[model samples]
Target: MGSRDLHQGATMTAMSGATIHQVAKAAGVSPSTVSNFLNGRPGRMLPETRARVEEAIRHLGYRPNRAARQLRTGRVQVVGLVVPSVANPFWGAFALHLEGAALAAGYHVLLCNSARDPERERAYIDELWADGIRGVVLCSSLPSLDHVLPLVEQGLNLVAFDRTAQAGDPSRMVNISVDNVIGAQLATRHLLELGHRRIAFVSGALRSVNRRERFRGFRDALENAGLSPDDAIVWSGAADEPYGDLDVAGLGRRAAADLMRGDDPPTAIVAINDMCALGVSAGVRDAGLRVGQDVSVVGFDDIVLADLAAPPLTTVRQPMADMAAAAFTHLRECVESDEPATGRSLLMRPELVVRGSTGPVPPPR
Candidate 1:
């Protein structure tokens, strides 16, 4: 049978009172054309045929069922977004931008929290797929991405953010991130320029690509200046802990306290993120030391509360909106394309925002 004849035969019986086939038969066109027209799919149809389909739909009072359409297509008009923690200020800001961008593009975003757990991330991925989510933007920082890659290979469009390089196959996934190394260098450079030689680095997880890159930047700046940055490093011991399970602020506070216990405490501190920096600042005050004057503190991410802290925060600012826009655009391209996006890594620049938290090193007693 001819293509049109086949469509007519397959759609002959009306599953619904006003089925797509009836409209196609009335309009003297194929059922696929009618389906396309009703679904707002863009295509060139003869003016008379278009008019006929419209009139037939009106005459038959046909209403397309979105649920049935989704089932037929095996997809939904939405995408999934997985983040380490929705409660983290940085992730929260990112989620808002992502949701806004998705909405602007006529798509909905289903936000899921991985809590930095592999199992939870795995489950969420499966659940999202079962819900007909064809695309996902993942911002996980776990040590392994074993669970995620298999799904992508199964035809899921994935955009990796924050810790993109860890996904193993950049060829099959869209990767987007800020130059965390530059951000850390900026923070460390600011402290060094302030004549703070004995600076302390407080960090949470090293497994996260962002954290590792930031640390590398920190070392690069110090080594470039002929200083030993390794002597200043202090792990927060939260590397293996899931997000929200360990209080990063408390980790900062404890790290600051431990550093102060030394006979020669650091003249300045650099925190992995703004939340930890705030904790470090509080720790300094609790130890009868001034922020800025006694010991300067610098942070990364420049979150909203960074400025509202006691001394405010001198930090590196990630371009959340720009990154979100780029990631959304990439994912949408992958979703719409017949070929997958490959081997492209977009690294955005971060700026240094000097606030009240950093200053010249204090005079020794």
Candidate 2:
């Protein structure tokens, strides 16, 4: 029922399979007018004409063929964003913020969940490119962006958050992110101040740059404190472990329980994200140990779930709202203007929020 599908024969009436022409003829307007009305464009049409088109389409139950209209306009007024794991609160919350900003900027967002699967991510990228979207945002990315580099190089208006193709590759991508290094350092130092000498850094996986950066911050903090940085205490080994990243939050929930139950475990743990902290908290409870009371824990990306846990989790708050706003701003600049954002590298600092999860370390158990 749109530009390309103006003819009654090319469209369908979901319920009765009627065409646009059928609806238009019954409504007393040409197929083109009916198509425009259904496509949400009524700028020049007369008030009476617009009403007639609407009534006819309604009476005949004509539904516009979005696929057909998308061809004529060369745009769907919709932007697409591909991110890893919506089940993770960080990406999930970012999705909401992005959709909000898009709508305020007179565009709609089409969300795609890659579930951290590389193949699925590549497929979504190709699909969005084919869909004629105005702009794109990639949250989780690969180590090599050579494949998609051409698109951005050709001025495709792409903004990336979280991760990008490779280090030092800003030729085609506008990168924006929270200062994960600072946040991680804050968490690590907090544990150190609490007198926990043997602190473990936990992550679901180390494949992501965010996690890697957090580890970097953790190491930096140790070195700053004149303490030897120990990689053996880092849980990046979870990369090969099934559901490693997903278990971070779950680990936070039971930290004390598991540690107390075990004969050997760190007195304090720093989770990659708040979700991982929850899992740690769970281990605390399962072992009947008190977090902050016996074992302290900290997490990153202070999501709402972090505050909702039994003892609101102590975490490093990544300014997700500001990060999302920056993504859209950079993309809009890239799209509406010819030049790139003259200044790149927007880094929002992470704030450490202490709650029930962290506390002074208890003597060795």
Candidate 3:
């Protein structure tokens, strides 16, 4: 084409919203080179070549067609995050942080609430696949990965954030988790140090990997302290299918009530989560006992509300934001690469946050 014809073609393309072809033509490069630049894989391009492509993109105000790119690449720049329930404060905070991190990486997050239902989790996965989303951060609370394994086999770039042990093949997907066992050990040892021999453990479902690990840690701590592990009262049951507040705090209250009614009640209680600890506090008051004074309580997952409770709860702190960022970076690498990225697992350290809800054991009557 002549100079005037080339100018006119560029103008027309600009008026119609510039695309890869127009940008490539203006830069005197192939479409693949433009694609490479757009995807942040500007490999082996001379500085002059890269500058030309960048200048063309800026001059034409070109916005790469994500849909067209998806058609060619078989995946979109969107990732789905599946959580058990956003209603839980811990998960709520987690989702917010993950969304912010994903946005910073030039990707969008599609939030899916599985409500701890197997069928719902499977349905969300199917919908995400149908919508061309190949990356997922699954925070499932279930004991089995039967519903998620098929998609992994089909080449989904999945990261199991919390309940990772349940994911069948750790070698096939990225896993990020907190050291729940250590967190639980810290809480239990804190109670033990306060001279409380009779400690109660209030937990949700033992099927959840995190909860199970916490329970094991509690037992290990008791054993290490030369106390009979069996003497540590444990109240755990099958969690509700459609998990809710009742499944958490309300169940905690019920367990606390049962523990209090016993002839030999525990002097201190360690709960599965902050929500449960809060409920146990309420249950203690209802049973004519002061929470921190009469019966000390400790919780896991120092959620935002942990500090706002009547007596701020002593709990375990997980670096949720850092974990989210690491998981997203790893999943994005898998999504954007030709081959799936090498699988890796990250275990974040958990800290103990001592607060007003726990104190020295009370004097015997």
Candidate 4:
């Protein structure tokens, strides 16, 4: 094209909003060279030259079309994240951080929620592979790693968090997680220190490694303190304790009439998560028991509800932000590494935050 034509074309493209071509020109480099630089692939280019392209793309606010970018560079610049049950606030926030990190690095993200279903997890895994993507960050694991093993064999980069054991290879995957066992132990130890005996453990699906670890810590505290954890004291739930409370509320004037009359009542309860603990709190109120006065509670995952609950929850605080950042860092390494390096798992220590929800155990009746 002539100078005038080149000028007109540039104007038209600019008017439409800057894309890869504009992004490249603004950086004074060939479009292919810019694509290589952005994708973190080696090209016969200098560091200073690459920096110019990167700076220009940032200054111009350029976003490349996903399709064209993929065609020019083998990398789709898409990080596929498979999370378990976005309904959980923990998973939801983690997904947001993963996407944000990818975006800041001038890439896009494809998020898929497995909803704790193995079948759906397999399906999403198959589809992301078929779609020809850069890599994946698998948040949770299923009973079978058949789908995942193949991805590794096919030379697809993969990293996992929270469920690294199920990934089948520590050297091939990175993990970002809380020290679940320690976190739980910390929460449980606090209650033991407060002299709570006959404490009940409320847990979610036992399949969750994190929850299981939390339960283990709770059990250890009871054992370490010379208290036998009555197997019956543990409640594995799907309906949640709150639903039992809802049923109680439905009883209207009769609510609290049958409080703990069914069997021996504990002075405090330990919950696997904030949601389950919230349910336990509801049950406590529905039964006319004064939480933190008549009974105390401890929860894990110090979610927002941990602080907002009527009796603010004393719980374990997983370093969600730091974990998120670590997950992103691990993922970027997987994305940018020339070839797979031996994978590493990193666990952040959890902190126990004592709030109004827990207190010294009430005197024996």
Report the Cα lDDT for residue 363, model 4. Answer: 81
Residues 1-365, candidate 1: write the lDDT tens digits. 12333355344443345677778888888988898786666256877778898988887667666578789877576889998777778888998999899899888999888767788888999999888888888887554668877888788888778764654563587678889888899899999899989988888767667778888898888898898756665555555554432467887887788888888899999998888898888888888898988999999888999999878899999998999988888878877774676778888889999999999978896
Per-model CA lDDT versus the true structure: 0.81, 0.73, 0.84, 0.70
Off by over 4 Å in 4: 1-64, 141-144, 164-167, 238-261
Q: After superposition, how far is residue 272 of candidate 3 from its true place, in Å?
A: 0.7
Give the least accurate 10-residue stretch of model 1, judged by summed lDDT: 1-10
lDDT of 2: 0.73
Identify the superior model by TM-score, candidate 3 or candidate 4: 3
Best by TM-score: 1
Judge candidate 1 against the unseen true structure and give its global Cα lDDT, from 0 to 1: 0.81
Ranking of predictions according to TM-score: 1, 3, 4, 2
Residue 160, candidate 1: how far off, in angstroms?
Answer: 1.3
**341: Cα error in model 1, Å:** 1.2
Best-to-worst ranking by lDDT: 3, 1, 2, 4
Writing each residue's lDDT as its tens digit, candidate 4 over 68-112 gives 655755666677888765666767777787777777886677888
After aligning candidate 4 to the native by TM-score, how far in Å is the CA of 181 from where it should be? 0.9
Worst 10 residues of 2 by lDDT: 237-246
* RMSD each, Å: 6.8, 5.6, 4.9, 5.9
